[model samples]
Target: MSYPAVPRRSAVANAIYGLFNPIPFGFFVAALIFDIIYAKTGTILWAKSAAWLITLGLIFAIIPRLVNLTQVWITSRRFSTGADHVDFWLNVVAIVAAILNAFVHSRDAYAIMPAGVWLSVLTVALIAIGHIIIAVRYSTDREYFHG
Candidate 1:
C-alpha cells in the first residue's frame, strides 16, 4: 500500500525556528523572576526591568510563532497534530497575559504588586507548558505502521 505524501518542513524555516524559539522563554522566565523580586522588595527598578523584559520577549516570540503559524496552520495540512494545536493555543494565551502584565507593570510599582506578579507567573507557566508539549510531541520514540 502507498501512503499519501507528507509535507516536509523547509530546512531554512526549521533552522530559524529552532534558533529563535527558546529565546523568548528565557526572557519571559527572567521577567517572572524579576516580577517576584519586585513583589518582595517593592522596587520600581525591578518592575521597570520586568516590563522591558516582557516587551523584549514578546518581540522575540514573533519570529518563531509566525514560522510555526505558517507551518502548522497556513502552509501545511500534513503537519497538524493535537499537540501542535495545544501548544499554539497555550502560546496565544501566554502572549495575552504578558501583554496585560506589561500594562499592569506600567502602574506604580507598589500598585502592580500581586497582579503583575501573578500575570508574570501565568505567562511563564503557559510558555513552559507549551514548550513541554512541543518537546514531548517531537521526542516520542514510538512508531506506528499502517497496513
Candidate 2:
C-alpha cells in the first residue's frame, strides 16, 4: 500500500514542533528525578508536589495535544508500516490516569493519598515514552526519505 507524502514543515514550524513534541517527556523525566531525590532526602511533601505538578502539566497543557497528535501518529504509522495496534492504548490510559491524578491533587485528599502521587508519576513515565515514540517517528528530516 502506498502512503501519502508527509508535508514539508518550515524551519520555524519544525522548531516549534520539536519543542512542543518533547514537553510530555520532559515533564515525566523531571517528575521522576524529583521523586527520587525527594525520597532519598526524605522530602515527601516536595516529592508529592512535584508529582502533582507533572500530572497537572500533562492534564492541562500536554495531554490534549498529545492525544490528538498520538492519534495522527498511530494512523500514519499504521498506514505507512501496516503495523498493528501498539502502545496507543497505553498512552490513552496514561492520559486518563494523569487527568484523574490531577483531579485528586486538586482536592484535599491529596495530602494523604500516596497512590495518587504514584499514579501521577507512572502516568508521566508512560506519556514520556509515548512522546519519545512520536518525536522519533515524525520529527525526522523528510528530505532524507523523499530524496
Candidate 3:
C-alpha cells in the first residue's frame, strides 16, 4: 500500500490555515444566535436565516478544514490512537450535526430550537474550537500537529 505524500506547509501557510480554522465556528455561532433570536421571536425568518448561514459556513469555512483532515489522515491513519479516535468522531459529529441542523431549519424541522442550539454549541462550536487550538499550538512550519 502506498501513502500519499504530505507536502510540508510554511508557518505563514499554517498560520493562515489556523486563522481560517475558526471562521466556521464564528459563522456557526452567528447561526446559533440567529436561531436563538428566532426562537425568542417565534418567527421563521430568523430560523431560515440561520439555516442559510450554517449552510454557507459549512460549505465555505468548515469544508477546508475537512479537506485538511483528509490530508492529515493520509499522513497518519492512526484512528485507534485514543486521541485520534476522539478527534475523528468529534469532526464527524460536528459535520453531521451542522448538516442536520441546516436541513431541519430549512425544512422547519420540528425539533426544539433550544435543542438545535445546544447541538450546535456542543458539536460544531466545540470541534471548531479544538481545531483552532491545535492549529495555533502547532503553527510551526517544520511539522504540523501530527508530531
Candidate 4:
C-alpha cells in the first residue's frame, strides 16, 4: 500500500542527521584497530576499549540508521526498490552483530574478546563493502543516500 508523504525536515534537522550519518564508519575502524591491538598484545585495556567503542557505535550509528530508514520511507512515501532495499538489510544484520559484539569483552586483566567481537567487526566491514559497491554501481541513482 502507498504511504503518505512526510514533510521535509528543517535545515537544522538535516544538519543534525548529517552529523550522525558518518559516525559508524569511523567507529567501526576504531573498534577493529582496538581489537587487533588487544588480540596481538593481550591487553585488556584495548579489549575493553574496543567493547566500549562498539557499544557507542551501536548506539550512535546503527540505531540511527534504522531510524533513518523509517524517516526516508516517511518523507518519500515509498520504499526504495534497488540498492537502498538491499542496503537496509545489510545494515540491519551488521547492526545486530555489533550489538552482540559489544557484550563480549571480559571483566579481567586478560584481554578477552570473544568470537562475537570479531563477528561484529566483520559484519560491519561487510556492510561497508556493500555501501561501497552501491556507490560505485549507482553513482547517479537519485534515491541513494551517500554515507
Candidate 5:
C-alpha cells in the first residue's frame, strides 16, 4: 500500500505549513508547564493561563492539520504503512483531549486541579507521539508529504 503521487503543495501552502506546524507544539508544551505549576501551587491564575494556552494551541494547529487532512486522506489513495493513520489519529485525539481540558479549566479554579493536569499531560503526550511518528516516517519514506 503506497500513497498515490499527488501534486506537491504550492510554495505558499508549504510556507504556511512550515510556519504554523510547530506553533501548537510550543503552545501545548507551555500549557503543560502551566498545568504542572498550577498543580504544585494551586493557583487559579496558572489554571486560567493554561486554558488560554490550550485554546491558542488549537487555533494554531488548524492550518497545519487541515493541510495534513487533505494530503493524507483526501489526496492520497492509500498510506504506505499504518504509521500515517496512527499519526493522524494521535493528533486528532490530542486535540480532543485539549478541548476537554479547556472545558475542565472553565470550571472554578480549585475544581480543575487533578483532572486538568492529567488531561494536559495526556494531550501533550499524544501530540508528542504524533510528532514522533511524523519524524520517523519522514526519515523512512522518500515520498513523505511534508518534504
Candidate 6:
C-alpha cells in the first residue's frame, strides 16, 4: 500500500500557518472580552447587545479560517500563496465594519449616519463572501488530499 507524502513547508510558513489554527478560539475570547468590557463600561443595554451580536458574527467569521487551518495543518502544512492575502483583506474589511458600527452607535457623527450604515453593511457582506470562498476552497482541497 502506498501513501502520499505530506507537503513540506518552511519553518516560517509552518509557524504562520500554525498561528492561524487558533483563530476560532481567539475570536471567541475576543468576543467575550468585548462583552465584558462593554458591560463593565455601563453602556446601554442595547449597545451591549450589539457588541455581543457583533462578537457572535466574528465567531461565525472565524469558522472558515479554522477550516482552512485544519486543511493546512493536515496536508499542505503551509499557507497557500493567496490564503494569507485573503486573510489580511478579510480582517481589514471586518475591522472597517466594526469601526463603522461603532461610529454609528456612538452618535458623535464622526461619519455621517448614512455613510456609516453603508460601510458597515458593505464590510459585512465582504466578510461573508470571503468566508464562503475560503470554506469552499478548503473543502475542495481537503477532498483532493483524501482522494
How many clashes would you count in candidate 1? Answer: 0
**lDDT against true structure, model 6:** 0.52
TM-score, one value per model: 0.89, 0.53, 0.64, 0.72, 0.84, 0.46
Candidate 6 stretches with Cα past 4 Å from truth are 1-78, 108-112
- What is residue 16's positional error in candidate 3, in angstroms? 5.0
> Could you give candidate 5's per-residue lDDT for residues 1-147 as a string of tens digits?
576564455577668877998899899899999989988998778988998999999999899888777767776526435776887789899899989988998999689888988998898899889889878877866656544
How high is the lDDT of residue 127 in model 3?
80
Please rank every candidate by lDDT, starting with the best.
1, 5, 4, 3, 2, 6
lDDT of 4 by residue, 2-75 (tens): 54453355465456656886787678778888877877788677877877887778778745574557655555
Q: lDDT (CA) for every model shown? A: 0.86, 0.57, 0.65, 0.67, 0.83, 0.52
| Candidate 4 wrong stretches, greater than 4 Å | 1-15, 77-79, 106-111, 114-117, 142-147
Across residues 1-147, which tens digit of lDDT does each residue of candidate 3 receive? 564455454465457556776677777888888877877787777777787788877876555565556545654454223344455566667878888777666555445477667766765666865666555544642254244
Q: In model 6, what is the error at residue 116, expressed in angstroms?
A: 4.0
Model 4: ten consecutive residues of lowest lDDT:
138-147
Select the stronger candidate by lDDT from 2 and 3.
Answer: 3
Predicted structure 3: clash tally: 0
Question: What is the Å distance of residue 29 in model 1 from its true position?
Answer: 0.4
The runs of at least 3 residues in candidate 1 whose Cα sits more than 4 Å from the true structure, single-residue gaps closed, are 1-7, 141-147
User: Lowest-scoring 10 consecutive residues by lDDT in candidate 5?
Assistant: 75-84
Q: CA RMSD for every model?
A: 2.6, 5.5, 6.7, 5.8, 4.1, 8.4
What's the true lDDT of residue 73 in model 5? 79
Total clashing pairs for each candidate: 0, 0, 0, 0, 0, 0
